[model samples]
Target: MTIMCSAESPNQPEIIIAVLAILLTLVFFLIYKRGKSTRRSILLTGICDSGKTLIFSQLVHKKYVQTYTSIKDNVGGFLIDNVFLKVVDIPGHERLRYKFFDEHKSAARGIVFVVDSLTFQQDLKDVAEYLYNILSDDVLAKNKTKFLILCNKQDQTLAKGSNAIKSILEKELNTLRVTKSRQVESVDPKTSKTSVLGEHGRDFSFQNFSLNIEFAESFGNHNKDGTNDIDQLVKWLLKIA
Candidate 1:
């Protein structure tokens, strides 16, 4: 009679360990792909004629440059204290702004929102609307981006200071909360599903954003005042970089 022999089944612990190893390898591969997929940025954004291009030139090109209006985004970078920081100067046209912002926001590390302080009073509503759009995006909040609300043209006599701009923006944003709440849909891709800006039963404040916001006054031109100059912006860049 021939002897009948059967091999034992695999060890349950060994099977589990082998499966876990494969899963861990997959997880690491995905993480590496995600890290390599996106480009990081410090974005320059605001309404047209808000000096974004000028400021961008100074920071990235180390000179003052201006165009009547930005037609497209300007992408560049500069070394900050030996660290290279990438920047994107988005065209602030109402029609064009959203597209550029959405494209780069996934990699945004900081946002520099330029404002025309000399014309702030006249541009309040437009400024408020555009700013509201930026602040409402769930992605920026999730990234915890640093925001520099740079009130440009601070050298002008009529320019609003940082504090005034902050106060005015708060009031306008509070009112905007009511207005935006009524909109059922937004045409923009990323901002279409924006998170609610502030807590209910409370007036809107910049603090409503988890973002680190700094309202600072500066002039993009070469005339550097002690604090009312690009120094503040450079300082801000250094910290974020």
Candidate 2:
């Protein structure tokens, strides 16, 4: 006379577990896609006439491009060893350079700071200042972005090698740190815009940073056979990508 409750199915628990596993898999797949999409960018920047445009073109087209001064950012995407990368060539003109840096700072996976190896001595201070700014940037430091100090124009006989460039830059950055310390001391702490490059009381070096900083030589311009030393840079990009 009284109605009886139906017994639960044995497969009900298995079905519920399968549903949860599928949902978790979907979440992980989405996260992997988002990370891959956001992490494949490299920023190319340095003083004006440092061969960034040439390197950009070479990477994109496999040939040197005859470029006038770049007034704005040059962005391109290419594949290396099947990994896609978006390389941004930020104009090195003093007035326009920083704007691009601010825009792309968070998206950058690595930074290529080009130096005209032939003219490095004259431009040493400028290069150091620019690099110091990058090393001290809160976003870059926090992200631990990889930095490549590319000694461009290395095909030229007078072009400095990567070792010389590294040594000179380290020395110059040390001096810059001392000078910046004095300037910071003179200004009100609240109003001072300068960020310290390295440890307070020690000499400045790339090793002091949380990020990996590397130095390498590259010749963006093609040789007589239409090849260049840009392969080294491409290798680095592949590694980071």
Show the lowest summed lDDT stretch of 10 residues, model 1: 184-193
Clashing residue pairs for model 1? none
lDDT, candidate 1, 190-240, per-residue tens: 542343467766787777657778877788674443222688888888887
In angstroms, the error of model 2 at 132 is 1.1
lDDT of 2 by residue, 19-63 (tens): 999999999999867865686779999999998988998887767
Distance from true position, residue 102, model 1, in Å?
A: 1.1
Name the regions of candidate 2 deviating beyond 4 angstroms.
1-37, 189-195, 222-226
Can you tell me which runs of candidate 1 are displaced by over 4 Å? Answer: 1-39, 184-195, 222-228
Best by TM-score: 2
RMSD of each: 6.3, 5.6
- lDDT of each candidate versus the true structure: 0.81, 0.84
